[model samples]
Target chain A: MSAFTRFTPLIQSLPSTIPFVGPEAIERQRGRAIAARIGANESGFGPAESVVQAMREAATGTWKYADPENHDLKQALATRLGVSAANIAIGEGIDGLLGQIVRLVIEPGMPVVTSFGAYPTFNYHVVGHGGRLVTVPYVGDREDLDGLLAAVKKENAPLVYFANPDNPMGSWWPAERIVEFAKALPETTLFILDEAYCETAPAEALPAIDAFIDMPNVVRTRTFSKAYGLAGSRVGYVVTTPGTAQAFDKIRNHFGMNRIGVAAAVAALADRDYLATVTARIAHSRERIAEIAQSNGLSPLVSATNFVAIDCGRDAVYARAIVDTLMSDHGIFIRMPGVAPLNRCIRVSTGPQAEMDLLEAALPNVLAKLAGGQ
Target chain B: MSAFTRFTPLIQSLPSTIPFVGPEAIERQRGRAIAARIGANESGFGPAESVVQAMREAATGTWKYADPENHDLKQALATRLGVSAANIAIGEGIDGLLGQIVRLVIEPGMPVVTSFGAYPTFNYHVVGHGGRLVTVPYVGDREDLDGLLAAVKKENAPLVYFANPDNPMGSWWPAERIVEFAKALPETTLFILDEAYCETAPAEALPAIDAFIDMPNVVRTRTFSKAYGLAGSRVGYVVTTPGTAQAFDKIRNHFGMNRIGVAAAVAALADRDYLATVTARIAHSRERIAEIAQSNGLSPLVSATNFVAIDCGRDAVYARAIVDTLMSDHGIFIRMPGVAPLNRCIRVSTGPQAEMDLLEAALPNVLAKLAGGQ
Candidate 1:
């Protein structure tokens, strides 16, 4: 492979590695269709009907570039969040925003702090920008806020990432504890409090909008991909003080947002009734997933997210076999953590009953095969 | 406005300046609706009915993140372009891809070459990455290809940008000359051949795909946003040698593509008839805009793009006055170049007759007002 010979050393040193293999890729490689698409933590409930209609209507204007300022969307979000539009900066998604954030704060050899097995995409961005990562392990399946703070102080790190209603394990801490963590961090450390799963988590699990709104060092990343059911829309925003949010403008691709995706996000925001109904559906589905895990002789962890992580009471290999068999044998798609300890469990996203029914029917058989193999 | 104190020196020094103000921001700031949105060179013809339908269908799965590998879209694009799937990399749009390309090749203080008064967004990305811009001025209202090649060698620059069927001035070099320019560059200099307008350009103006396929230094960017009438879809791809194309995997947001946008692009590619019809429409609209300009005693440049650049026979002040009056008085939105020489002319995008009718009616009045003010 003869690549361009003049790429920067940092870029040259980087590996062509993706944070996660999407289920669609798996289907392609395996030559089988995914019957239950529950990996990647996307909402299978889909967007509101109004959002779909808005997207369909917006499709006609697909010839025009979306507004570089994202004026209307920012105004709508600001009005809803009770802050000035200047306090919000939108991007393609949280993944894109994380890249921009890493670029802004990290120089070569700079240290970044995160949980040992938090969102891999954030870590990918940090490494892409030549930032060294200092990871603290999860304590009791929840991100260790104290450990993260300790790492930040010890390394004098300029950046740290924490996801509330955490991914993979579906764990969360109370709002006050989260607020305390934010307040306790040194002002030099920029905290990315990712609230991607906020819509599905209990209200008490979320800090109030004003709790850290005055702090320029704290940014809360939110998305429309979960309970709002627009993951494919790729719309996400960062909420912070005006000065902090404006930093995104220094490096972001101003004209990057897709026209229909912005329209879908705006419409999704307007349809609170539909969101409430979908939230109920997601809760019910989570319980059903837990029930499915219990019936398979697995222990499902308590979840504050849109998914359940079931402890298989075995090693990582056994969990991996279950995940592979469920997909290969039954066309039921699921994912698991990449690292040890966490890899002892399998993760499944909440979806419509049809998908849950497929998972329910497939899990027991896959577990039986795994047990027999053991 | 206190910001995080620990931002890198480069980031701290950079200003939060946007390359262009969106029409929506103008509408909000002035408290008036845009009657004719012909400023940004967006296709007012809109996308095909089939593409719209595809987006509508894809919206039902909006809860799932798009394929991280973009496997299906890549296959579709490759099949359409008569290339292997590995020869392409998809992104949010050409603007986003430009950012990635700049990041890959430019380190701090590295010399990056482009034509003066070329694409501002491309320049914006180069500057954001801390690359020193070495500009070659346009000659006779067209990019000076010889000058650009000279500057690349003089500076020993690693990256250079050239847009065929150029923006702002709407001029293009013949395919043979463009291929010659690419071949003449030092092998170490990566060339970005922006063919965003290739779909509408005269066939003789575009090089064959395999012309520079072996160079490993040339990458051509194309977008569905032009003749396909899917600018808002934000679908763009780079065609290059497999090695050069694969470099994008090192840092691109692998799952950044919007699902419906990808569906729309795939559908747009399949509907060749719609693309042909829209191309004719754009060509006709260009002729209409030229006629409108000539009627107003202005000189419209010959264009192979979706927009026309009209010489108003005055300095930048007069051109600026006409543009401001067009918007403030009649809600007709148009734009002009950012630098001198080229800034003496105003740019207008091709649109439906209704928008052209607005432009036709408003231009003479705005020109008269400028004369009256003088």
Candidate 2:
């Protein structure tokens, strides 16, 4: 148990904890394989066939380091988004970019604001940089934009995070409200407008790419993980002002990108037809999930994301029992939000029909077992 | 030219710069294609067939995130190295791991010790974390171990970096000397014994894996990017005490690993015969490069790495001219060290026969042109 004793005080004060325990860890810990792999919001539909082919082709060149400037991918993204390549910055994923953003802005003891039960990974980064957390509560299972702005102004926080088509709860605010919130924030406050679930959301739920393209204080993060269905590829980017995007070059691991992953993302972007088809399939799957939840007498919240949150009409204890029992007894894996009120709901990601079929059959029996005190 | 107004003072003070200009950027800037890529120490020999096949196979699972715990890869590495899984931590690459290591121990103004002309990426990380650098000059081309020890003791520095079979100069000390240096350091000073080229080094040049396994202050970093010929795979690991290894889990992006890249590393490790073949090829290429340099009236240093550093019999100006003319006139891409003494040499990475043939044909012509004052 001997450790190097000279770690920075901030790093020493932090716990060695994962923001979310991945499903693989659960399988290992429980000695059971996940039958319905819908806990994480990864698209079970997978990436386009062309993307797989592109990755396979790129594999032959695996000995070459990826372009440190990320030229090709940035060019592709810019062409598609109606922006210049200088306005885009790529990273390992949105998670990695979030860490970089925190480092770029937060000094020790600086205040960062986010929803109480928002993405834990963001909170993890904020704390890693010795930033003080100033959390607002989720209002109506959606991130409270006005509350977040109020907290930011009160603390004079340098950073604020708000995810559209949010995770865990799968709720979202319309584009107009989000744009209003962005414009209302103080110019000094940097806003991370995460659009990780935008591809699966209603058109009205996402602002236009040009909505804040000139706004230096706003950075919108997008990912290839959800609708593009390449979660394992680890490609994500930030859409911000050119100068803001360039700031990342100061500290990012210049050659850290995986070559095949970049190729996968580029291929995924090129296949617009595939994206349209997959988003439709995702929508269909979400409907199926909602139907199953309703049939089991659970109230499924309206979600714009790739998942649905079903209210169990009980406390966190009951929700915890359902999550654990489903995983342990039936090999089903689903997750719930981490805090009060939100934890009253269990989140299930949309997946292919086979996984949906498994969830359909297991939920009623799990409810019965719980009702009968197991 | 707009950016967020309230970035940290440290971030504001730092310039946006990349440590190394990638060949791709050079190609873009020069408006030419590189006919021979022997720069950046990337293995143009490429990865093994088995590794490529594994990556192609893993491409289908690109929709699922890599296991955050990295269980399979960790198990494979531990089994190969005869250490427990807890004694290792994986990252995007050695570059990424160096950044994490810097963040772990360094606060603003903390002194960090390294060679004067060592890896620029390591220096970038230290500077990015606001650590004050204390550099010891190289002795004869090899890193000066005693001088580094002196600096660490003089500054009471918490961190020191020394790479074996060093980059740019490609020089190394005997394993016994390295171990002696490690033992001589104050226990309070963390030693980063970077064994990036160990696979290609002579048996006497590398200490046994268990040499510093019990030492809490020593962390040895190894990469598949070198001998395994998988630079684009972005898989590197740290061999350290279990406690120190666990510290990475505190700040690392848990799910940052690319699925196909990890698959390639696992496959690369499993195929020991291919590793042997590639390392042999690398060694052969190095000899061919040395011959080319000698025939061109240059002094090629004995190299343990995949690259040879050839003394141009002049100053940095001559080395810089040779590098620039090789690329601009012959489309041959190579690099030189960044500082004095080391900058008298131009570094060439070992590659396949084709690239060596290009270098063989071009170096004399470029030298002739330089002699003619072109």
Q: Who wins the DockQ comparison?
A: 2
Residue by residue across B1-374, what tens digits does model 2's lDDT show?
99888888888878899999999999999999999989989999899999989999999998999999999999999999999999999999999999999999999899999999999999999999999999999889989988998899999999999899788799999999999999998888899999899899998899988999999999999999988889998999999999999999999999999999999999999999988998899999989999999998999999999999999999999899999999999899999999989999999999999999999999999999899994
For every model shown, the clashing-pair count is 0, 0
| Model 2, span A1-374: residue lDDT tens | 98899998998998988998999999999999999889899999999999989999999988999999999999999999999999999999999999999999998899999999899999999999989999999988889888998999999999999899898788999999999999999999999999999999999999999999999999999999999999998999999999899889989999999999999999999999999999999999999999999998999999999999999899999999999999998999999999988999999999999999999999999999999994
lDDT by residue for model 1 over A143-162, one digit each (tens)?
99899999999999999998
After TM-score superposition, what is the CA distance of residue A159 in candidate 1 from its true location, in Å? 0.6
Q: List the residue pairs that clash in candidate 2.
A: none
TM-score of chain B of each: 0.99, 0.99
Model 1, stretches more than 4 Å misplaced? none
Alpha carbon lDDT at A4, candidate 1:
86
